[model samples]
Target: MSKREMKIKPVIDRTFTDCMEQLQEGYVCAVAATAGCTVEALRRDLFGGDLLITRDGKTAHDQEVSLLLQLKNTTTVRPDPDKETFSYQLKKREYFDRLAAPRKHPKLLLVVMTTSPNQTEWTKGTHDSLEVQYCCYWRSLEGEQAADGVQKPTVRIPTRNVFDAVALTDILDRLDRGEELT
Candidate 1:
């Protein structure tokens, strides 16, 4: 076929938000797998949560600990000069309320911030490795009150709460020990 006639149309168009969400979800899934846990995607986005994590092979009523995660992605989060924390504004009041409320399952807001603004640089792959250019932080809003009449509520996430395999394992261990995740 002639080069001019070989142009192919894009099959599906995904917005930047969609791509970011997918990337963050993939990262969480990988981390959970490595930590010997299982992640379930909530198709309906119930309770403003995107995913649920359950400890593997621990079904005892006392030992069973399931975590609910609300995943968010952005390229705009800039940490404070001290690098102690960063803030993210949640757009939905419902989400804020749900996350802040006490529930049977602990819920956390997991925000994935991209290091670069360029979407093309978000991921890189080679035979030896695959790298995702983003870092995630987790915050628990339980017992916190949302500002009344505010459509969007901003929450601060600690830099120390990096969402990684170690962090996941620690969170699970804490939950299994009947300790609060806060």
Candidate 2:
């Protein structure tokens, strides 16, 4: 492959990587909320049907693909202020890299959702290694919940950017369309 062709592969891989990280974080949230539920159980709770189904359609439960999409929206960028470490928060880039490795298939969709007002630099270091499609951040009326039900946490959520054009999307599209982007 030419230099341009060589460059394009990494870009596509990185975009897919970002998407996968989002999916993994989503998976973590789904797992945490369910309190150690199995992946299938989590799937049932979130998607209502098996993981194979993608589009929003009839399923065993009223769960919509949109609900599965909520994973992208459920991340908390910071830890509860009272909590010592940001344990529950996902490591965005690392998660993306693991999922986007060569042998893996793009089986799931992912995105970031935040409850903070500013997200200008959230995914800063991972662009070269991951495919972060959509990044969405919103304000929280109440922030950081404690272990008890008393405290509400502030956070941000970024949904999958499958809807539009982004650097990552541009790269993936080019690759998919049999073109090269250096």
Q: Which one is best on TM-score?
A: 1
Best by lDDT: 1
Which regions of candidate 1 deviate over 4 angstroms?
1-14, 58-63, 80-82, 106-109
lDDT of 2 at 59: 48
Give residue 22's lDDT in candidate 1 (0 to 100): 78
Stretches of candidate 2 exceeding 4 Å from the true structure: 1-71, 78-88, 91-101, 104-109, 116-134, 137-164, 177-182
TM-score of each: 0.84, 0.23
- Shift in Å, residue 81, candidate 2: 22
| Cα error, candidate 1, residue 35 (Å) | 0.4
lDDT of 1 by residue, 1-182 (tens): 65522332222334655777778889999989999888999999757788989876455445556788988776667565478877889878887888888876554655545444566777799999999867788888888987789989998889888899999999988877768777
Q: State, as a TM-score between 0 and 1, how close model 1 is to the true structure.
A: 0.84
Q: Rate the local accuracy (lDDT) of all candidates.
A: 0.76, 0.32
- In angstroms, give how far residue 120 of model 2 lies from its true place: 21
lDDT of 2 by residue, 111-166 (tens): 33433222332333464654433333211111223333323222232222222224
